[model samples]
Target: MSRIGKKPVELPSGVTATVSGQTIEVKGPKGARSFTATDDVTIAVEENAVKVTPRGTSKRARQQWGMSRSMVENLVIGVTEGFKKELEITGVGYRANMQGNTLKLALGYSHDVDFEVPAGVTVTAPKQTEIVVEGTDQQLVGQVAANIREWRKPEPYKGKGIRYKGEYIFRKEGKKK
Candidate 1:
């Protein structure tokens, strides 16, 4: 038995879960998210918790059981508490600003890069070098952060570019004379 799959997922207040065929939909005050379970995995919603079970005893079934459980649990939590990702710009002229529903980034490039914020996702720049992305869906929030981060990945030589807050970048020293 899978340890994680065996544990029941507790349902928070104001959250409702419905299983339709192979898809499980979770709705809460924040928003709603759905995920489909694999063929070998099954999800059961009880009074106040969710249980996952594997149809057969096999390596693939075992793996899908745990993964499906975790995905469902994430959907529940995401709809309830939401998710956020923070990014920081590092460079002499690198900065980020939010205007309306767009994020403008200056990453030492000749032209500024503008990214349109998708509906249901909020982007805020507390500081010129810091950006915060908030959304009720975990997958959307993470994808938005990654798209912004791709604008300027950190360079090893100078450790300059966009990076997640508290992320460590290995710096390479300049060659000796």
Candidate 2:
């Protein structure tokens, strides 16, 4: 028996969930999101909560059991409160700015980096060194932030690059003179 899969996802007030075959759709004040589970697991909306169960006692089924439940829970949370990721830019002359849907990044390079924000996800530069990614989908929000950080990952030596907020870079001693 899966520990996490045993508990049902409770629907918050003003949030609703519906199951259509293998797909589960959740709607809340923020927005509506859905997910399709694999055949290894069964999904249903019972009472004011969503439940997930495995079809058989196979390894794949057990794996999908917990994953399916977590996915359903994400849908509910995503539709209700949404997801957000924050990035911090370090180093001199490194900054970020957002113009409409395009994000302009200056990371010690002569040419500015232009990142086009995709649909559904919103990127905002509240400050020159701060970037905030927000969206209804948790995966999309995290992926977008990761893509942005990929342009200038924080280095261990100087730690000059873009990184997630609260992330720590392991410093390495340099220059054995």
Candidate 3:
């Protein structure tokens, strides 16, 4: 049995969930999100909570049981509280600023990198070295932050690049001359 799957996801006040066939939809103050579970698991909303159960005693069914439960939990969190990812830029002259829906990044490149913000996700630069990605969809928020960090991943040598806030770069000893 899956530990996480055994726990039902509680629906907080002002939030609601509905199940249609294999799909579960959750709506809250932030937004509404849905997930379609595979046939290996079953989804249902009962008594102000969402539950997931494996279809049979199989490895795939057990795997999907836990995964489907977590997915439903994420949907509830996403609609209620949403998700956020923060990025920090380290290096001289490297900075980020939001210009409308475009993110202008100066990552030591000769030309500035303009990243067009996609729909549903909001990108903001609270400071020159800080970038904040916010959205109801956890996957999209993380992907956008990763894409932004890809432009200038933190190097182990000098650690000069963009990285997740509070992320530690493993330092490597330089030339021992």
Candidate 4:
């Protein structure tokens, strides 16, 4: 039995959920989101909470049991609190700024990178070296942050690059003199 799958997702006030076939949709103060689960699991809403249960004792059913529950929980959280990802730039002369819907990044490149922000997500540069990505979908928020970090991944030597806040880089020894 999956520990996480055993618990039902509680629906907070001002939030509501609906089930249609294999799909579960949740709406809250932030926004609305839905998830379509596989046939390996069954989903239901009862007593102001959402529950997922495996159909059989097979491996795929067991796997989907936990994953479906987590997905449902994520939907609830997404519609309510939403998700956020923070990125930090660590390099000389490196900085980030927002120009309308575009994110201008200076990662030591000859030209500034103008990243066009996608819909359903918001990117903000509170400081020159900090970028904050927020959205109701957790996956989108994380993906946007990763895409920004990919432009200038942290190096092993000086660690000068864009990285997630609170992330640690494993340093390597310098070449012998």
User: In candidate 2, which residue pairs clash?
Assistant: none
Residue-wise lDDT of candidate 3 within 1-177, one digit each (tens)? 899999999999999998889988898999899999999998988898888999999999999999999999999999888899999999999999999989999999899999999998999999999999999999999999999999999999999999998898999989996
Runs in model 4 lying further than 4 Å from the true structure: none
For model 4, where is the 10-residue window of minimal lDDT? 73-82
Report, for every candidate in turn, its global Cα lDDT versus the true structure.
0.92, 0.93, 0.93, 0.95
Which residue pairs in candidate 3 have backbone atoms (N, alpha carbon, C) closer than 3 angstroms, thus clashing?
none
Candidate 3 Cα errors over 4 Å, as ranges:
none
What TM-score would every model get versus the actual structure?
Answer: 0.94, 0.97, 0.98, 0.98
What local lDDT does model 4 show for residue 151? 95
In terms of lDDT, which candidate is strongest? 4
Clashes of 1: 0
lDDT of 4: 0.95
lDDT of 1 at 93: 86
